[model samples]
Target: MEILRLDSFSFRYPHTQRCALKDITLSADEGDFVLLCGASGSGKSTLLENLKPELRRNGERTGEITCLGRPLQSLSRMESACDIGFVMQNLEAQLVADTVRGELCFGLESLGFPPEVIRRRVAEMASYFGLGKLLNRSVNTLSGGEKQLVSLASVLSLSPKLLLLDEPASQLDPVAARELFSMLARINSELGITILLAEHHTEELFTLCSKAVLLHNGQVSFCGAPREAARFITQNRTLSSDAIPPQTKESGSAYVFTSLLPSAAKIFPDEPSLPLSVREGRALFKQKISGRTPPAPMPVIPPTAPPAVSVTDVYFGYGSKDTLLFHDLSLTLYEGELSAVMGANGSGKSTLLKLLCGLLKPKRGTIELFGKRGAKPTLGYLPQNPRLLFLADTVQQDLTACAENLRLLHPEERIQSLSEALGISDILSSHPYDISAGELQRAALAKVLLSSPRLLLLDEPTKALDPFAKSKLAALLRGLVQSGVTVLFASHDTEFCASYCDRCALLFDGQTAATGAPAQFFGGNVFYSTAAARIAAGFSYDSVTCGEVRNLWIK
Candidate 1:
């Protein structure tokens, strides 16, 4: 049975000149796992919102939309809200309740579900998604990943017939992300839920989704199998995969772990498709090494200068709760380094970053920058959300303002060089929000580049990029490394960490479990690589980049 159908559906913003979704015709049958992918602003959100008609405003709409046999346009707000569960792109904005329990129960209470029923459902969902422990926790206290998961659980508790998810796992760590997807798959398989997820991470999504739809510029460019859409996007690099009909790549076999890479342990998988992520690669490698000989890798640390970034005797937390985010934690980052901090939700990976970037003061101990310790630890910082830009009316104005700010202090630089390099030269005059997320990320990068800092601290940098955009970022990071910049990035993309990073640090229980190369860290231990890496299966002299792995073949 077709759970929902859209026929010749078209819509535009209020009084807008152009259509936001033009001739958008698509359908999702009952119990189908559908992946809706497109570039930023490629009608993905528009279409998802249209799935629940009550969300749409006074926009010009035509054609027929039926949801569970009801006319979509005529459905009441309450009915539609109950029928469709939406987990939006910006989780922060959608969150309404003050506490975790309140947020989860708010909707159920409104629907007049028995308080006992709501409580029971809330408990089930909380435990199911690991939120049971944080029931009384304040919503704002949760990290990006926790908030997202909580929001998702809140929606899923409704048992919606159609679930609309826009990058639900975008801000989680690799372990958390894998767990989320695993849960999603389990729910889809068990609950007869129809899921339409718009995402940027294709590697894992491809394995999970049964069908794929690529949208570009408010139109459906292609709708088919995951492999077909992957090929289409790969071949076409000129257009954003989600926005325009993408050209599939002819020969590149890279996955997109833009900011991460794993170790090249001497364990290889005897499988069909080699893994492209650390977790997947390591799993396969583990299988191969089992009942067989394990190859030893040479210790990667060199007998040279001291570690690049070192934290000693650090104790930190917020208010007086004694959260003890980091308890006397000490670590070292060697020179010419690309290191990552990995942990589950609320493990203080980000808090540690804030201390390193000089944004927060440590409750105890000291942090060293390149060889010195102080309040002014010179480092470049890119927050998870790039919301620091001044409210300039136009994109050109934003750039000019950024350049001007950098100029007033340094007075010895040029904008054309960095702007061109970052590919933001063309869109220098558009509104910041009007631009795509990828472009906004790039522009933010360019702005940070202007400061010419020696060290870079990035928090979940690949939140919303598709595979191609992610790969481009990985290449750019590699370039920065070659240019002698050190990076301390936090990412949920395990492949990114396993492939590009020289070392991996796993933060757990207010302390780091291990800190070493990807191979050493992921090999023969509780720590794991990504699914792509596992699928790649087996060890090569070098593991492929976390984002991409090509077969060692000429075909």
Candidate 2:
């Protein structure tokens, strides 16, 4: 049964000239799992907002919406609120309480549930969501994954029939994202809850979703079964192709996607039953490449580039000596190199960036730039949440604000040139919050580049960007490196590092555990490796990307 529907819906936000969503028609059946796919600014978030009446934007609308066999307008506010649950892209924005138990009870309390009922529901939710251990813990202390889980569990406590997720895993690491998706899959299967999930990462989701709707510039480009949608996306590269699997793109003749890429390397488009897991992929690999002898792994030579930033015997922390994060940790970042710093949450990766940026002073250590002592070179730093840097109402205003503080290389033309360079000139008048995360990222980057820094530092720079945006960012960083700027970013995106970074360093236990080329870094580890590396194992060393593996296999 159709639980909700939209017909020829169009919307334009206040103070905006362009429509955010246009002639969008879609539906979600009871117990259906719909995957919403799109580029950064393709109207996925706007569509999800329209489904929940309370969260709808203040805009001009022209269309009809029906919910549970009734006109959406005819439903009461309470009815609309109780039937649909919306989870925003920013995890912290949705959290309202101090503790896990308090968060779970906040909604129930607001709904006027008795203390007894609220208590019963909170206990049930805590146990079911595996948040029992964290019930008494402060919500602020939890990791990105934990916070998202609490947000979902808190929303589910109300027993809403429909769940709307907006890039729920955008801020999490790969392992955390996998776990969240697995839980969502279980929720769809066991509880029969209808789900409409908007996401940029679709590799693991393709196997779990029943239907998919691809949005392009606020219009439905493709709406069909998940597998068919994969085929459609493969043929139409312009339609947010970042969500397309790496293994699928590696197929030279035809686009192919199998959850088990190790076993099924590649398959023809005509192959109907694509393997959906590692086991299935392995079985398929045995059937195809049974007796072929695999190639030997290559050795990685250490980089000999001149040092750009050098750290020596650094001992630093926030509060006291006992709280030291980096103790005698020494490392050197090379000039004209794109280096990635990676580690688990709370492993001091971000602290390292702060130390390099001069935001945090080391208690006992010396940092040198270009072999010069006590010299502070021009630098740009983008924190984990770049949005925090936004201070003005509009993108242009924010850029202008940044211009006032910049040590401009070109003093005559200020924000205009930088805005154009970042491709945000078109949305200069729009509010920063109104833009997509990817656009905001570019805007933030433009603001940072105002000073023309010789060195750049980014923390989780790709947290909310899709693959297409990531490619653009990678290219942009590469251009900066070519221009003699040293680039270093802290990230959990292993695939991106393997594909783009010149070097990768694993930060752990107050020191650099390993530092080497992408091939050597990923090829040495099993669990902390990229999907392409795992799939191409035994095929060739130094093959961290699907394209590289494909070329080697073809040879």
Candidate 3:
């Protein structure tokens, strides 16, 4: 059934000159999984917000929005509950309770649902969403992916028929992302729930969303099949931010995404589509080349030292896991080296980072950064949930809020430069809560950079960023590494691991499966290897970074 419809919708924010939604019309039937794909600042979220009036503030609208033949404005707040369930990008913004069980019952309780009914629905939703284990855990203890699931389950606890997910999987790990989407698919299939998801990645969504809609600037530009959208995006490389629908697709190792990329990137694997960022994708492609192993080029480093970081017998994990994160996991990161740690979700990759940053006391292991221990390591750790550490109000304040002893030297210079590079410069004065998730992350990164630490620890650094931001971040990390700094990041994007990092360490089931050259290591793991990497004969030493592969080709 066609559950929702928009007719000539046009909207503009009070102070803005440009219309956030321009004469837009769209429709989705129950059981249809529709995706709104686009870049950051695109109208995907704006359009999604239109479904709920609470999401808007003193906005002007000239068109009609109808849900089940009734005007959107006329539907009672409680009626919309059983109809459309909207999930915003920022989970915390929507979360209301301290504990997981409390959060699940919030919406149901608001409606005065019977206690027994709430209990039944909550338990069912928790088990169905794989959140039963987290029912008693504090909301603060959950990871990004876990929180997203909790939010989804909480929404489901209300028994809504239509699900509106905004950038839903942007913060999830690969395995969890896949599972979450799969669950959504089943809900649509069995329960007849109509799903409309707005996201940056589109490749995976292509197969899931029966119909695709691309909003450009604020207008409906491409509304058609996934394959057709993919062709349109691939052919038009010069789409303006306002003229093209945001699209991202998984092509190979890297996500080939842009306003021009297909919609699969955001859908599958929770990876972004490369908007012409093929450093890692190309590197993986080159690795498959067989005939003769190409000779390696002269080393980029000028006869530099061997390495900077060394970890031996690293063992760490949560209670009752019955295994170390990495038993006998040994690896070293050379100075001026950029390495990516790749693996499926829950691979203890984050734990490995904790050991390196001294966030966790290793159970039975030793870690040496710059050949030292028991000292404040020069490592800058970017935790998965950065917003928790934020105490200041304004973006500028957070970046420069520290006192003399802890203050960054010349923070203004670094903040302005890094902010512009990461595309968060315009919102420097805005409150942290007012900005986009992508913008906040960039701002946090700028703050981290201000400290000028020698080693950077990034846990899923690319979670909510768009292609442009991702490219800038990659370049910035590269620049840092070239300037004698080192980076060790955990990520699910195989293309990123291949293109930027000098090496890759694979983690699985709370242990390091392999640590070596990305190109070589990726070749053996189906979950880690890129499409091009698999197609290419094989990699030389699991080398996944583009510079390495390009030099290897040249030689």
Highest TM-score scorer: 2
Angstrom error of the Cα, residue 405, model 1: value is 2.1
Minimal lDDT window, size 10, model 2: 253-262
Model 3, TM vs. native: 0.78
lDDT, model 1: 0.69
Return the lDDT, model 3, position 73. 90
Per-residue CA lDDT of model 3 for 387-506, tens digit only, reads 865678888787777423366566677677877777777777777765567777887787777777888999888877766567778888999988878888888776556656677787
Q: Write the per-residue lDDT of candidate 1 for residues 1-555, one digit (tens) a residue.
A: 998888888988664577878898888899889987766556777788778765565678888889888788677777777779998877887789999999999889988899899989999999888887888999999877788888888998887888998777777766666677778888899888999988775556666777888776678877776655555444433322112222343422222211111122112222344343456555654554455432334466652646678899898888875567788888888776778888877888778888998789888998988788884544788887775754787666665676687665543344676666655676666667655666677777766766777788888777676655555577777778778888888776766676668788888887777887776665533325654344444543333332232332201
Deviation (Å) of 308 in candidate 3: 2.4
Residue 324 CA displacement from its true place in model 1, Å: 0.9
The TM-score between candidate 1 and the true structure equals: 0.80
Q: Please identify model 3 stretches exceeding 4 Å from their true place.
A: 7-23, 54-62, 91-106, 115-150, 216-219, 238-305, 317-329, 389-393, 400-412, 534-555
User: Could you say which candidate leads in lDDT?
Assistant: 2
Give the least accurate 10-residue stretch of model 3, judged by summed lDDT. 262-271
